[model samples]
Target: MGAHNGVNNMHEVAPMEVSVEAGNFQDAERLDDDGRPRRTGTFWTASAHIITAVIGSGVLSLAWAIAQLGWVAGPAAMLLFAFVTYYTATLLAECYRTGDPETGKRNYTYMDAVRSNLGGAKVVFCGVIQYANLVGVAIGYTIASSISMRAIRRADCFHTNGHADPCKSSSTPYMILFGVVQILFSQIPDFDQIWWLSIVAAVMSFTYSSIGLSLGIAQTISNGGFKGSLTGISIGADVTSTQKIWHSLQAFGDIAFAYSFSNILIEIQDTIKAPPPSEAKVMQKATRLSVATTTIFYMLCGCMGYAAFGDEAPDNLLTGFGFYEPFWLLDIANVAIVVHLVGAYQVFCQPIFAFVERRAVAAWPDSAFISRELRVGPFALSVFRLTWRSAFVCVTTVVAMLLPFFGNVVGFLGAVSFWPLTVYFPVEMYIKQRRVPRGSTKWICLQTLSITCLLVSIAAAAGSIADVIDALKVYRPFSG
Candidate 1:
């Protein structure tokens, strides 16, 4: 019940830090004097938050990933990742409840849950990993958004050049512009208040995804059928088994990244206006709806995209769509993607903001912003807030500019974080919190699966990083 109210005010404590000092399970629940539920969001809005987090720039790469495995392996991998992610995500949601399902204590943030079950040391470790992953995601959004914007402009240039000269648009300026746009939304108070933006982002995800699928279908029809060499069953004739295995690993990483909302599950759940007892059910419903909705889009977009371009599908599906006949549609799709990332960037960044601001206030209790007293004129803003938030945005923007390869960088982050943040932590936390016996088959299977996922993700992450380094040999910093 001590959830953030989602709106920032001069008088109230930020929800992320509200109960940190209470030091007990019972204190985790913050209720009004009347003893009613205090959370602020409903099922629909919470689902939208999950959807917005899960289906970001990652969706843009699915076609290229699916192309790695051909039609047979790709869709199957997509379904497998969705199923596993949803199951593990629900396990994490159950961790929020501390006693009887009908009456239990609840933890608001992911670190709160970790501290409760794993102790303070583990909490510190988790914080480092969690914050790093979030910053990585924000950078990924900046890179992906800039790429989308540049794609549209480059398409325009192609026509102007009569298709005889190469397009010369640059992505650096747009990356900074995207960062500036994110800074505006990042200043918005909390997770709950941003529901409208999340809703719009969710809509834009579907819009661009739909547009991609539609264009793919039309292109396929015009071309008479699917065009790639190995669109049916086997890998391309020249693809070595080693190459196929490597590509499959990358594809799995992409699917894992696409389904990753586990890092923000509790934060999103905390936004739902339900008591601890009903929180699990609410989260289950929200996760189910979100995973189902995005899965449909992922499959359609992946399949149709592969069908349209086959081996030719670029790492980004929209960029590969290009400015063909009826090129305006491609432009519209790119714009929708840029708009969606603008919101997605903020949703992921808000938690990082909360974490940083809370720590600074705790360390310097007399600070202007932490004092609950409003300031005016020149003293209107907290220097801490302005300085750190701007720094976070700037850091991410610079990273994106330096490492401009979208698919590889995002995949590396996803592969590295997916195991611990999404799979391993949830399963381990659930087992510890519920006291699932080590000898139990269910317990053994879960641990084994978690370990397997971690190993696979590590290999994928390493491969992704190596691929990025190789690709960077020819990458110009400001080139489109």
Candidate 2:
């Protein structure tokens, strides 16, 4: 398809040029010291992007998932997932490293890199999948955020003996408001704003974890025993083995490695500017930071939640933690979650918008309104533009809201969406380009390993899809 401009021409962009034109740089000398368009981000900016990306709606469910796998398996799975995520991310970096440097400079997007190495059809497929996943993720986050907000409000009401169903009372209004806010946040012009948001989220997370831990300790001391001492904690006589199994299973779903790892890889690509050398180093550093930060956070949160609630930890761990005393702490945590989710939405939203913008430019060359400059307005105002980016966000948001119950479905879509970008396309490109040389056995072995990793990733994504389908069946009525 030829490139055009405007919303109507979105699908007409040739997939090969997706990256080159995404952040069109006309005067590199003016923007960079080396005559290349300088990237206006640093190490921390990359870390924040990766952290926000890795921590999302899925994080709220970590305790529940870990409960299913038990403490040992859950943490182990997270570690393994982190490793896989890093490895695959490295593969993507390698692809960028070997790409045509000139083309890389022009179209540095992930899709452009894939298209340059693979073909048009694969690029298109990857684009569609990526778009679908981001939209699903945005919707899921919005719904989950609404649910969390409602739960907190309801708890507040109940504490004062007030009767109200926060879920039913203002659910629709809150959801729409959240969706709008999410869109606005996603359009923030630079990393400075996002960095501040990330700091807020990090603070909230630490505060929530600390409060939960304190309460658990106090409860133990008050009962004349150390909490989690096994002997000190009382077990309910009526608790059954089956119930424990169910709780553990639920926890396992949250701590599942595949989904979490895939997401980290996606963030690595999204936040960093792609082109070899630069993209490679950025991806490597970002992946390391994301994994390290997320792993520590998950472990700390999981331990604290388990200690505080014991076997009674709610299916959504964050909800249970919020009930811990120091009401202000909980309030901060709530706000933090909201802020973090906003950041997540921005990271997800940008690429979708860029893809749309690229397509629009390709389809309608005459539409000056859809040109890059026109699309680069304030985040809120920019959403109204008839550009591919805006159109994708609007369409995705509506679909996501309509399918609010499809949490697993959204996760599955995200995993699937990441495959071509993070795994398959990268490996294929590396093999085809023969950048490593065919005569070397080490290179062949590396290729085989890369291929194996992609296959495993696909399998993992497939399993997640199955889970989503099953979840959809169980929650069909809620879809309305």
Candidate 3:
């Protein structure tokens, strides 16, 4: 199947062709003439990628969101979001299952899928949005990482000088450190090394949640016991119905905890080496596992965090609960989370690089022209021929550092990019390609559900964008 450009005589080839042109880089180091990764399929490889994608800066934010929404609605919303996630994930898996194997034509990257389902312009639009979103996530993760480190230092009395806050030490030093670590870790030539870091991150995450939850629960119980004394110490009151609604709606960001795993589906597809049919099954299973794991973790963390803070929990729940007595454990957890955030950055970076590489090859089909344009030494030209790859990394780092207060932006972009890629576009492909029985009950029900999901996703995108704007307007200093 091919697409015809509006220009009378010109025809843009099928979007699937780009996948063939882009070439799978999963095993570039061990690439055979077949243009496929050399590795055999394994369950662990798929599982690790999914796990890394699911856990990120979102972990801290989930509980705060739950606090905003009523406790009753929080888990319900997450469950609903999980269902939506599963449906969308299954649709994409179906697309992959039916995709052409020889040309790598079955599974399309986010943009390719969008272009095929919608049109070329949308592909470009979504690509730009996705790239920006990934950059925001990377920077946001870095900022959060730095803030977590600073918190640990202050808790341990490392800031000997009379500074009120550890983070205030010097942005320059932290920025330099963050940049060096990002470059070194990101340049690891194989997934094996990356997986090792992920394992460390997972262990740290478990420890962090366990410690933070225990301390938070203890504090909450203590505060509750002394409720009589704090009777009139109201921080704020719930007055209007609208206020309650807004609060509840805000909590829906907790559901986004699962949305963070959307990229994992793509990552698993890219990393695992299997025939198209097996790859599709693997992607489906991986997506389910990732979301399930994230959901359970968020629910546990949210409940504990809410109990700890009670009505007084700070907006950022995790930070509000100071590190507990096991100072060394807190330090380890903090460091581990920072490392996990780095892995999250890589998750965000891969697609950005892939998209840029495709555009680069398309723009300059001639190797010599591409080489001259990239302007690298001939020896390095083959490996670094894509301008957008480096451009994305530099631009992402600069923007992330400058927009240090980008939590809402990160969440918003995560939702916005996720909606079309995860929900609308995939459904569109399924309808057009599969053409489920037109008048049958199942077909009608499916269409109705798809339409509803599309509307909900649009609302989510709009709300998230507004939230980002509000956050930017009220940027504050790192008081901790």
Which structure among the candidates has the greatest TM-score? 1
For model 1, residues 174-248, the per-residue Cα lDDT tens digits are 999987877656656566567677778878988888888888888789879876544332455866666666666
Q: How accurate is candidate 2 locally (lDDT)?
A: 0.53
CA lDDT of every candidate: 0.77, 0.53, 0.56
Q: How many backbone clashes does every candidate have? A: 0, 24, 2
Q: Write the per-residue lDDT of candidate 2 for residues 1-480, one digit (tens) a residue.
A: 001111222123222322244355333222332233334444556665566556555655554445445556666766765665667666665555334532443334566666667777888786776666666667776766666675566556655654443333444556666766754565654333455565565555455445444554565455564223232123357444543443333333344422443423433443343233465577678667777777776666655555555545554555544354444555556666666566556655665655555676689877656544434444433322444444555665565555554335433554455445555665666667656667588676766765765554455456555555555666543233
Q: What does candidate 3 score in Cα RMSD to the true structure?
A: 9.1
Instruction: Order candidates by TM-score, high to low.
Output: 1, 3, 2
- Least well predicted 10-residue stretch by lDDT in candidate 1: 8-17
Candidate 1 TM-score, C-alpha based: 0.87
lDDT of 3 at 216: 63
lDDT of model 2 at position 31 = 37
lDDT (Cα) of model 3: 0.56
Candidate 2: minimum summed lDDT over ten consecutive residues — where? 1-10
Candidate ordering by lDDT (highest first): 1, 3, 2
